[model samples]
Target: MSHFIKQNDPSDLFFPGGLFLNSDTFPTSFFSLFPSSSSSSKASTVSCFSWGPTSRTKVVSVFSVIGGGGGGDFLSLSLSFNSRSNEDHQKHGRESRENVEQHEKKKVCEEEEKENNNVGLVSHGSGAINMTKHLWAGAVAAMVSRTFVAPLERLKLEYIVRGEQRNLFELIQAIATSQGLKGFWKGNFVNILRTAPFKAINFYAYDTYRNKLTRMMGNEESTNFERFVAGAAAGITATLLCLPMDTIRTVMVAPGGEALGGIVGALRHVIKTEGFFSLYKGLVPSIISMAPSGAVFYGVYDILKTAYLHSPEGMKRIEHMKEEDQGLNALEQLELGPFRTLLYGAIAGCCSEAATYPFEVIRRQLQMQVSTTRMNAMATCVKIVEQGGVPALYAGLTPSLLQVLPSAAISYLVYEFMKIVLKVESS
Candidate 1:
């Protein structure tokens, strides 16, 4: 059999071995990139391959003819093969790579989410621990400071209740002569028991209120008014909860008050003789005094502390103290300086005491009287005014100031110092 080669127009060409071809050589390049095995091609030489483009893909085709001829008679076979376009293959490869990349990104995001959850748990635990520490420090500081001034507190209570205006020296002499040194700390245990929980609640509640208000306002710093209101609210809450303990302490410490053994005895005696409500005898007056007193005290203290911390003189003093201590940081130096902190604390205490002094007198009278003899806060005020004039309301002012100034100073100093120490130790 002889084979004839032909050129089809100018665009088609002929090749050896009865193969007809075209000018477009892309199919040859595609075959070069993805060569089929000779064995596979021979085994499947049915010579018909069909393919088409899809919406997601594109197709390329190759065509050839094989023939044998004798004289004018001829036998011919045509073969066609389809392959994917390069652009379609590239597009599929890109999609596969993108899917893998997205999976890896999802894994990374899940890990980050787990880490954030752990951090949040840690932060919540740390905050709870800090609040507990703050409350403990405040309670301890109040107890220590109150104990330190227990004698002065007893003397002041006597002066107010007995309507005595004796000089401090005469008062001391009288107490010593009549009841000896033991008289100075007669009701100290009750005072401590009362003060510990009172101060704890006061400090913790104040902090809670301040934090909530700060978040509500979306501010890092609280205004003076906000501070005042928070302090008042804290005081009112504490007083209401601790009224029984306060009333018992007042009754036990008042001049010529009957001996009730101890805190338990005092409580029992009031309950048995006066009724349960009697334990809260002066609650109204106490709240009236304490709310404003707490507002003044905290407001003044915070304002002064902030002012001092930012002041040129205060900074110089802190720097000097830091230089002397050498081991202390700026914050430690500020907290450790007893004199300056005490001075501000005393000022705050004195201001608060002055504003609320008359209410103290009224509260004491109410606590001392029996239930039947008890008068309303307004009536008590009128009686005191009529009996001893307006000045009578300030009968114990001198000793009260003397007692509170140092008590407040020492309490604040101890609280701040303890807080710093606790923080450092915890860290």
Candidate 2:
């Protein structure tokens, strides 16, 4: 076995200016402050220092500053250096660096959390403003479109109810002769009251359902099926909620009826004469007609829009328009530079209205008889078929299509344009 001798240097025990001459002369009272290990196999060194005994009060004050000022004890400090392998030293240094980095990361995360909280508040305020704008757009679109087609709508209602085959001019002259020029908009106020909120709810609900379903399916783009389903749900919900208003409007517009004073008077008369359920007399047929009609309309519209956007000419036109109108939204861009959007909207309206025309006749018949005969949807359909055969079920298809096509086209155009304008203004 080989023996190694340990050597200690005098300079290691002294301060820079020779404050301590040797290790033996250093204060021994504060030695207990330092931990001493007797295991010499592990090479280690301990250095202890304190203010002199003569300045014990000053030492206590210095200790207070260095030791968090908790006690009056004299100042004492110990520094220990342990000899270890290079790997151990490197490991310790890495751990110290990691701890510092973790602390800094925690501080940054706290700041980001605070900033996100503020952003959430701002987003909530903006969300409410956006919803209000959407409601306004929907209400305005419904009122304008309905107003434009009021005369045709009244004529169609008369044909469906009375089986009148008069031409447009004759129908107008008859209404003028009976109720004067104001008869052109016989039940327009009731229509507006019914349609405004109905359209607004439909629009808002469709967007809500579409967004939720898209997120659930993890899809950025919704398929035509999704759009159709969302539209059907929106239509059904709106129709069910607003069925009473629709029934009242139909009754007020039917030709050869005693004039109801106004919406309030019509509602009171219906409820007083024929119970509350009369207000929703044809709800089943109305839902049956509207659900599929809304589905077809929205599905066709979405399919047509997608097809147009995918066409080379449509893409080129959009790019050209983008250069001219940088503020256009995605929907507005689809409408740019062509009447294709109008044509597509008209086609969708025609298809949906044609498919559901028979149901419209059935619904109108049921509503018209609210004060007279209380017939279920099945009885009404059977009676109509017996009286005039299957063609009677489609009595007013021509005027219905004529009125609906332009109404749908104009409503969609105005709605999409308003959304873009509002978005741009807000931005």
Candidate 3:
């Protein structure tokens, strides 16, 4: 780090003019001729006359200066045609290269800043090292997010299963009336246990596939179409891996009084009661929903990051820095600017969630309905609509929207921070 301070001294002003000027062009006697307070106190003037052996043109120059008060001496710096030659051109090239190298070195100094500029698709393998680091970071973040929402997730399951509309307050009241205050979080422990690892697998697989597919298409940089495909792949992979867990959580969260002892118990109960395929009742809708939902979530984030980096203000900020000091590409810039990235991610997730809420409603109902019913996701959706109108398919939309905004934002923000931390620690 370099600290630069301004020096205040009259002599400092003379250093540049003396070093560059020729004695013939600006003689010592000229300084004496400069206007003092006694000569001129009102204004400054300049008159130029040239005369010498090379006097193709003779010019005489005169300048007036006002002393005291606020006015002070002014120094002029300019490069005339005579000053620039082949030698200067060569010098300029050397200086430019030095600046480039300096910029590269400075960027290396701030590894964290560099990390912030990185924008990785859920897909696209940067390299083995980054792949592992990103995967672990995403997995850990997913677990944290899921853990926090376990109780609400359980309540959502119950509400969906009962086919009822209940606001948060009423929902809490209902839970307390039937199962005590603890009932509000009836299956939360199991929900967390189920979703934490479940979400890890979900995000990991989604990103992995998304990256690979885009790479195959020669779009590892990932276009909008590519992002949609990548998000969809990741979502589907994750949804598949965790389908069984999804079923278990739904049942446990349902209004039923049966307290399945553990994950093993829950699985056993579902299989024994409703047959093996029952565990995947909502699989189709979930798979269908995951693709677009995931695509939109990540795609919107990328677009936001891209827009932020390209903005006028963003460009000015980068311009002020030494190119090497500002070690961020468009994507990397947003990572550095986490709040902007977060806003993008939040908006994207909310939009995705809202768009697919109908599918979500069907998936929830299929998973929670439990017995004597082999309802396909499509059939479930149709039934909900026919019975309770379109809004039935978006029963818990308020809560869903509420949960998504912050959860998605925090996940992305923390992910970016973690990347910075990892880069610093590793370096």
Candidate 4:
């Protein structure tokens, strides 16, 4: 990284990002971090604070900016890092660890008090509270992820419904030209209308399904595959409950859909003209696609979490966490933290989106049709392929991909943080 910058002449000094300095002469010496080892008998040694947050300021090594060789080594730079001695690290870690003796005593006392006070009911109460927390977590996570990626989402829908052959920028340009900048957020109200309920149900249902399936299997805990099944079930549940809004949102941005009017008008128009069943025109494809989509997305995240918990590095990460069972299970008790959660969610999202994208494309096409005669999933696939080759099946995929990474990552991160903040139950 440092090797790329070059200096033109002795009079000119170069910095990164195209910054240049003109100088007739350069300072031969600057104040020393460590006094000249050769010039003085007693050289100053580096010292650092080793207390609390201010700890770890030690200097590993220092190089003089201007060496004794002078002009031969112009602007010589030094690299140094702060590190703690093994003993200091050990001492800090020990002091920071919970007092096991005191913790055990407190636990015993609390358990005795609970037993005497009929606190067994508290478990059920806490579970109910946890459910509420889960709903809050899911709602916020959904709203944030949806709003953050609204533009890309609208663009993706436009590409799908318009069947445009334009690239990402070109599609965005077309929307901007036609409807101006706000077109990028077309139907976002309907989108959000669906999202809160959709994700709240999706997240809560995943947990409920996971627990039931785990118990049905006669297990104390859930496997990653079980998590996958539970997630699929959850997706189907959310889709069924909130799919109407999704359909309305799709048409509002599609070509010729403005006739249907705003969200309420579009919904009423569909029901009045095509019948109530028309609200779910693409239900079949939606369910089929969501199975794999939800499974891969939610399943991969849980799998990553489980894998991390079992890894050596992950074990080290959790050492800082309180040992009490504050989460609902082994999986919940362990965490991957914010950054890791985001990263894993992104990977999961990519896999889910890529795997089920064709179904999504088909589903969107089906949703837009107001005609009595409509194409089935298989027929729609055939039509899309016939129009623009196999690649056409992935027409809006670029914007979808662009939207999903941060969408999934932030969704999971925020959801997890909310769960913590809201004091959701542990195992």
Candidate 5:
């Protein structure tokens, strides 16, 4: 909220023969140099020195100068010290209390500064309030993006779970013919419930991990490798934490699993038939796929964003904004407009899905397995290969990309928009 403006002044002040002062010692009588303001027009000098050598403390000087006393213009100076005799121990307890209070106040001020240094994980310093904003932004982003891609998401899940038999057009025709337009989002409510927390955790975990890494490496800015590592760790943590919701969502959206009802009904069915642990059905494949999937997803976005920001095109955009006075600092210049943010995110999501589609298929298939038909990650991969050859491992990749591209784009767009709305700055 504060801005700088340079001022030009012709007034000046100077000292002749150099005014030298020593920290180790000071004369007790500063008033001897000049008479009182009422007696003469000569300026008076005041000096206040605080000494703390005995406690291994640094001496500090704090003073204020006020010219003009009554009618004449004069400089007033006062010098005083608080060195009490050791024998005067009566006020020792009060002094100790005052010292403690001063120390505590100073500490509080420092902590406040540290807390507000930046905005959440995007800032140089993060606090709980900032992190909460990140969580909220992430949740909103996930929900919005997933909702926009619900139809494609359902179609993609069907292709992954039911094996590759029909082409995209044929599948669309079948869904329309059998279930009508509404069928495209049959379990979208459940999807939202599952996705919101997953993304919230994903984004929060990424920020937390990246912040820690930044500090550990003592880097002024996060590198692409650090972003990848943080994204991967975030994926692992999020997938593991939200396994139950994820498992239920996978089943609820798959072909015959629609009969399982809503979230509560699905929960009871899975728990009763497959035991409680069934909730975490495909954790192994989830972690494996998600780790790299997340790495590419976040890393690509960050790398591309950095590249664009430094590119002539991006620099031009920033410069334009700066000339218009819309940009305030270097950090503000890093933020891309809505279209660019979406484009970068779309690219990142597409690359991530394309690179990790096989693992995703395996993970989803493993999630489809129940207690009676359990399969490990390797076995699931082998089965898919046997069923439809190597290509089968990438079944639904087209729809997956379709779903993820806009989904990721919107996620980032919404996230950045939320940051603006929340008054939190982007990194």
Candidate 6:
């Protein structure tokens, strides 16, 4: 195969929605390095791989601003591979082995480009656009579903504090009898506030880190391990950022006079009685589960997105469409924007919560104790296991599933719609 680099002005490419072209777009330099292929070869291969989140971010932004954007590149690239010959396959394999060295060179080039672009005042107004969209969506969704979260949390707490195995109906009745209908929303506002920002920051951080790391590693693609680190880091950061809010939310949600009174009262009670550190109860388990959950959720979403956008049928349709209708038209785009993000968020939330549901039980128990001396999170886990039996770790799993499935779905859907509406008005 013969290789060549194709460079072009950004204006030469189709402007999907006619948005701002930053400094990089003017007199832009992009490498479309292609491998050379010998004619008469039964099978030929051309693999164009780019590391870093630039393309991903671009697509997301396109979708956010214009209603629809280009789908994941890898998905399309994979489809191209189906027609490759044996010789092409071998060549591709050889190149894959040297992917690391090629990546290092690419990184240097990207860094230089970034520095130069910055000097020219190329503002990334579009930077973090997707992140913002996700954040707003998440916050709105969380707010809409606050009641569900509160009730599930309440049931989970009751199972831990009162040793009750009550059904949802029973739990609802019990909570109503004790705290009234308003009790269902206890600590809800706090949860919405905390979860929205937490989800936004954590999700964006993971994407940012993963892209940067993949680019540095010289890998043409993000490896699972890299994704894991990114997800884990984001999860930890989010947990820490929202820890105080979580503590307050949890205290308020749990049924106890000391915690129920107000934020000030809760703060004083935890400080004067349980000590300042009590605010971080159940932190460990939360951190542990968050990372993998994020990795799986985002990674899977990326993969699926890639596949969908690149499928032969999908590509054919896109290529065949008129310029105006080629990408996503306004109405088509609007219809999909909110629902897609909503589905993505819901899937991530449910999968993550399910994987960590047991830990959720343990954390609530630890927090509800109103007292504990263990400095480490692991010790708390051990203590809970020894005292409550292994089964106790999942006491409220039912309620969690009940609440999370619909709540997440509703929250994400509403969030996406709200974001689109806001974008429409802003535009």
Task: List the pairs of residues colliding in candidate 2.
Answer: none
lDDT string, candidate 6, 4-31, tens digits: 1122443443334333322344331221
lDDT of 2 by residue, 1-427 (tens): 0121111454444334222223243454544454445332221234334443322221212111011121111222343333343345556668878989999999999999999989998888888888888877778878998999888887787788677878877887888999897787877878889998888777766776766777788897888778888878878988888899998887666653456776777788889989998898889998998899888877788788878778997788767776868765556564533276678878888888998889888888888884556778999899999999999998888888989999888777766666666662231
Question: Candidate 2, which segments miss by more than 4 Å at Cα?
Answer: 1-112, 255-259, 327-338, 371-373, 424-427
For 1-427, candidate 1 gives per-residue lDDT tens digits of 2334335454444445443433242343543433334532311122334443432343333332222231111123554332445566667778878999999999999999999999999988888888788888889889999999999998887788777777889989998999899889878888999998898788778777876887788987878888899889988999999889988888776644566776787888889999999988889889999999989988899888878767887788767776778677534665437787888889989999999999999988898888778788899999999999999899888889999999999888877777776662221
Q: In model 1, how large is the Cα lDDT of residue 101? A: 99
Alpha-carbon runs more than 4 Å astray in model 4? 1-128, 323-334
lDDT winner between candidates 2 and 4: 4
Better of 2 and 6 by lDDT: 2
The predicted structure with the larger TM-score, 1 or 4, is 1
Which structure is stronger by lDDT: 1 or 6? 1
lDDT of 3 by residue, 194-295 (tens): 565655555556556656666788863657777777677878877877788778877765655367866788889889988998888788899888888888
TM-score of each candidate?
A: 0.71, 0.72, 0.61, 0.67, 0.69, 0.59
Give lDDT for model 6. 0.60
Candidate 5, 32-91: lDDT as tens digits? 454445443233444454544344222334333222222212232334433453323435
> 1-427 in candidate 4: lDDT tens per residue?
2223234565556555333322234332433444656652222344333334534434444333323222223233343443555456567567656566678889999999889677668767877878888888899988999988999888777678876666778777777999898887777778888898899889898988988899899988789889999999999999999898888877677766788768888788788888988888899999999988999999998888888988998887677466645544433443786679889989999999999999998998898765766878899889889988999888878788989988998888888878777766542
Ordered from best to worst TM-score, the candidate numbers read 2, 1, 5, 4, 3, 6
**Predictions in order: lDDT:** 0.77, 0.72, 0.65, 0.77, 0.76, 0.60
Better of 2 and 6 by TM-score: 2
What is the RMSD of candidate 2?
A: 10.6
Better of 3 and 5 by TM-score: 5
